[model samples]
Target: MPNIEYIITAEFHIDKGPSLVFQYPHQLPGLQNLYFLPELMLPDQIHKRNEDYTLFLLYRNLNTGEFQYLYNKNNCEPDPYFLYTIVLNLTNDEYKRGSQVKSLSILTNLSFFKNFKPVMMICLDLYFKSNDHHIIKQLYKSINEKSFIISRDSLNGMEINDISLIKKLLITSILDLPINDKIYYDENFRNKILGIGKSQIINPDLFIRKDLSFNSILNFNEMNIPIRIPMINLPDTIGDYLNPTDLNFKPNLINILNSKLSSSILNNELTIYGLQTPPIIILINAILTGKKILVMSYENSSGYIIDHILLILKIITGGGILSGLLTRYNIFPIIDVSKIELLEECDSFIAGTINPFFKNNDKLWDLLYDLDLNEFIISSNIETPGDNIIKSSIISEDARFLSNLQLSIFNYNDDLTTIQLIFRRHINEIIRILLSSKNFNNNLLPNNKDLILLLEGIGYYWSSDTTKLLEISCYQLISKKFQNLLYNEKLIYNLILPNLSNELNLMIDLHYHLQSLNNVSITTKINEREIWFNILKFLISGKSLEIFLLITYLIPPNSSTSLQSSIAHNGNITIFDKNKGIELLLINLFNFDDQIKSNIIMILQELEDNFLCGWCINLFLKNNLIYEIAFNELINT
Candidate 1:
């Protein structure tokens, strides 16, 4: 032998046994007798009757661990012979000599062997495990292909006997095949090997056997699978997985709570005012329990305090209680309780102005009453003005508190003077906040009665100064909400119309917006003659003639002709004097045919005097003009 290498070993068991057969390559003349003749391998020696032999070659690439097969006979052959040749790679001689003979066995009963004849040929190389002569002889003797045609019931009994071993081989071989190979792409073979039938398989991991044990399922779970969960960093005060209190809140638990809260809010299970209440309660409880304490000096405390106070005000104004607090105190007592000590502990304290409205007001004071003056003094050390607090006061129901707060913050010489100035400065901010509030109504002026009272009081105090009061009131009337208030006849004539000026563009815009309101009677509030006079004044002012002409055309036809004639004559005298008269008159004549007819004769006379008659005739004739009878009469005149 040429340096005998590692032997391929395989075992096959069939119905009849104890007789071995072997095949050798043609080139190995010394082993010629070991090769079975074609007639002996075939059923009933059919090759003796001149039937062709179908040679099925199973080729394995030892270097790459791949297998493929091809048949020698062509498709035209009526009864082809089937011969299977399996190739196995050789190992190094040194290892082959030292290694023990290892065998891989495939067990199948005779019926299974016959039913799976093609599979047997395909898996031959994989079934063979060792090249040891004794092992090869033993495997060869164990497989008796001639006795493989057992009856159906006997085959069923044999299938049960060998199912475990057969299943292992089938699964291993199927899994080992290259994924993109044609053999691996055969769906029927794949399903059959995996024991899938009838219904579709859902979990591929459970393909081997449906009755897999819990441990096996767990093993599958441990295998790599694609699943993703997005991670977020939470504040340390929220706690960790082990201890789920605020001191050690788990991120997952907080995420779950947030998800639930968001779902409730989106589904409208909670009102807008109730949106932040739960988080506020959680924060307050965390502070009270000493799980988390927010420590800040008065300089930086406004953001935290302002947000909580706004929530508290909204809850109280909306007729809801701050659930866990004592009934004797209002919602914000906790601020004084916790903040005073924190403020005192800082290195230096800067005493800025806290809102004066909050200091002695009955509602807020009743909440702060339990606190000592010493604590108030300490907490007030670094108080400063915050715009958020002022904005919040816009919607708050407590007018007295808001007034007091404004007076304290601005340090005005008198309450009336301070409020008048504040109103002038923050009017836009106040109106914007009021319009954005949930309860705002377009038909009402100053929808909140509290805001109405505040403005009314300011107006009353400043009644003597009509100029300043009128300016302050103008801001309110121009706002959309206040414009809606003018739907009331008395308010339109008495309050709003008095404030509007006769400026042309402002009046135009107001007229345009007012036209959309079917409920308001515009003619009752506006003097038509005066508006027309102002519009005519605008036309003669020569500021915006196009707008003037547009407005003139919109007038009732009986009223517009005189206005158009006046405009055209004015343009003739002044614009013609400036030598641009013909162009201007022609523009008007083309744009407003009905409105400018009365002025055409005078305009044409101006054109004749300006030496533009020939130019106008040539321009019209070049464009194939057809002169109307009235236009011809104007020209003739």
Candidate 2:
């Protein structure tokens, strides 16, 4: 059995923004009494105009603090019908752009002494649909009972301004803005305060420690990247089908037997013949062309910087060369066409337009002749093929021609075993090239960060001694080229944040361990903290509050029971300054989808409780972290 009503009509004014009407009732008082669309629902939307807001009046009896539910003295309108509606004339355009937040007011019709002046209120918490609520608690405080006021137009005696009406309007308006911002209820209510007329309430903890050790020395905060390990199913004791194995290492010899493709084209106008294009050049061109795949290939094939250099070369050369191109293998203008005809039969054709005229000039003709160009060009020694191939085979062919022409002055070793080892093995080729570097061969490592990172990523299990070499190389990075790049306060965070766990106990250990690393780098302490800060910053921030939940597990509010608890105990007020990181964090707060912002604020509250105290509230009262960044970020978005 339910109580049903017929048409209950009431009149209001267009004050600021749009309006929403629910058939049953609205929750928030003032303009917010219209919030009952969710709890009750006489659904209708009222839009806003000229960047203003609508104010509503929910009256209360002077003697009884309860809202007067009657509308008029005659009782046709119940005492509860004392609510006033504030509306704003808004068409679709205002809805598309923004929710014009003008001033908020209480109803002015009631008769009391027209006393104190009224103060304007701004409603900001949830957009009808956005999830960001990082500042919800702050907004609630802004409209606290002690914050707002109302008076007559003449600043004389006020007509009507009820505290209950204001409080009701504020509580409901902040709780539910344009829509239900989903974040508040998530995270098990870790970051938000609950209940009114406060007494003893539920205080629940939301995290599970991944590490159980009280005195464990593992520094979880000193970790940058998540550890990736293959998980196994079942095989004697659970085997992995997810990763690598020995059986997969065998190469496809079919590729070796097939003819390799070429890049040059001996076309109508431009001619580039017998020129070997460097792999570096190909890579560089790929970068300039925005060929991501080629850039990736270059990184895997060589070092990233070297790949970058090669990419540069490619851009400089314009689609230059590839391996095993007959057109680039020193074919003179008059050389045998018959020989090239046979090469073309293999679904491959080489072209000219490759420029290395510096080497092909008469200055190198005698040198080329001495190197036996005819042998490379014709590839025909029918009767004596076997014996000649044994002495001067194609084994060192790519190297020799490249060297004699001065295209690449690479030294070639006659050791057949070494060349054979590198033929189809990328690693072996990389090692050979590394050894070929005059500096590297002399035990001098290059001070390149990208190279070191790439080497580190190769991982120890994949290559034992080589992996050790790469790790050792990282230490050498202490030289000038690195120039303390990794030491950046924000950059060093690669050391903090556990791979997949949240535990403060681990952070303490990390702090202690980082203290030990003082011998490695005097900056270890600050670096560790900096990294941890970054992780926390990211965890508690984003378009949503997912990071906050993750961060809560790291720094729990009850961290030191013996310590003085302030609201935001670790709430370093430094970021509150404009142009600082915290300012940026606040700015991003407005952009979060309702669901995400709610979750984050709720998550932060877990630690917020331990921090919430007279001092903390005092701090919040002074926490003017809002700046140009926050305002601009929201405006731009």
Candidate 3:
């Protein structure tokens, strides 16, 4: 896909103030005379800094008319046509004519648009000097023609085993090597490591890639400049451009409140309803249940608080389920009093404001989070639309889970990343169990009686409002067939579940492939050593749990293996070997609840008693020692 959809420049004039200077290729459909164009380009204070950068989002509405606040009021599903905007400010007296500052921006649908920053910088510099439209035209042509170094088509096949093989090929090249994030900006890893003798040992054509590749350098002959893609990226990290690094990203939810706000206005009251429930729990519930959220702070800039809130949302959902759930399209990171009327036109959003006037009008938001007071102010006019009796169990479950997480977080010396993993896995587990429910039929729609049971059990009410929200939630990460059925008939069965069965089965297949590997002596080549390290890294990665869960879920009496014959007890089959079974179980033992843990102990005890399978018990003991060392290293780091 093309990275740059449109390029435009905005300038601040002493007489006319902020206005669009020019748009490349063709003018954007409805951007001309946009009410918020000034805000998009200049932000709060553009002249304060010598140079500045701002990020914003807009939808591709082709109206080309007056502002319509109610455009997407009915549907909250992610708009597939959302555009991310990056504005680069050049504040200097060198600019021509009536403006001292000019803002250059690229509007792209890519969440990884940060990669194109270098290109943007050069383009802006060149445009400033030459004032040639052809430079922008050449950039548009070159970016669109750029292709992935490796074929992405290898992952598009129907057979997951084939996809798994492709993943193995991709991951193994990066295997056993501590990711050199430096590679994202420097010369290629192969070129950096390979001397004359080493070059012969390693294949020159072999590709070593990362989860995100930010170092893809592009050359524009027309402009006579080369630029490397930038490093920073948006929250959604699962894309072709993802560049996995050695350093693990640990987002601390407790520290989500802006330091400026918290330091100045720290409050003892972090609860609601006279100290019964934590405000965070209420906030999570509000977001999950599809309520309009407005976070208000009178402190300096609203950007920090807004960014932190977005980070909190991203962390809670693990960047997987929330990818298409809510995005920049659904948020206004910075809001002022002037946009209040437009904000009110939308039925739902999560907005941040420095303006105190928003608090005076309670009807403006369904849930108002006051950073100054450290309180959650639930609007009196807003209420959850469902039977309280039926919702009790669901509410309890959510509260129990979140409260446990909150309590455990503060009480432990454990790694914050580990806690994040546990939180994410909990969410994935919920999706897995929901999709595996017997209440849903072959068509993937739930039966009425069982549907209500499913809904109530998972904390949803059976109503039109819930259904609409569900429809919006189900739009992303689902098959086209499911999406088609959902759009045609608004329903709950398609809600929030990401075809878990297929994903789990893929993990299982990948596990089977891993087991199929034969033991071999370590190779002497640097490339071979690098591959080994990458593999080990993958084993310890947070994402590795997907494959690990397949082992945990099919343990005890149900354990089975590909190399060995499937062991059956009471119609359930266990797959894989005893050593792998033990390794997998030990790796994710913490993720399992009490009941599952108890069953695993019983199964291990049975293996311990049998003289023939006694070696399995010894292997388990041996692996546990290695696991402890690795665990301690992970925590300490």
What shift in Å separates residue 157 of candidate 3 from its native position after superposition?
A: 8.7
lDDT of 3 at 437: 29
lDDT tens digits by residue: candidate 3, 6-108: 7777767666777776777677756544556656556555444455555555654444422222234244223333233334445446555433666677766
Q: Where is the poorest 10-residue window by lDDT in model 3?
A: 263-272
**Cα-based RMSD of candidate 1:** 38.5
Candidate 1 C-alpha lDDT tens digits along 1-637: 1111111222222223112233321122212332332221221212122221112112223343222221111222111112222222233355433221112222221111112223333234333443334533333432331222111132223321132321221121111112113223555533443333445432332222111110011111122222111011111101111111121112222221232122122101111123332332222212121121221123222222222232222222111111111111112212233234433342221111123333533221111211112121112222222211111111221232234323323332222212222222122223222232211234433343323110101111111244333433322322333233224211121112112222243223222211211112443343323332333333322222322222111111111233235345653112211112222334334433443444544434433332123333333333333333445645565
Global fold similarity of model 3 (TM-score) = 0.55
TM-scores, all candidates, are 0.14, 0.15, 0.55
Positional deviation of residue 426's Cα in model 1 after best superposition, in angstroms: 11
- Reference-based lDDT, residue 541, model 1: 24
What is the TM-score of candidate 2? 0.15
Worst 10 residues of 2 by lDDT: 231-240
**Residue 7, model 3, lDDT:** 78
Error of 1 at 261 (Å): 16
Q: Highest TM-score among the candidates is held by which one? A: 3
Query: Which scores higher on lDDT, 1 or 2?
Result: 1
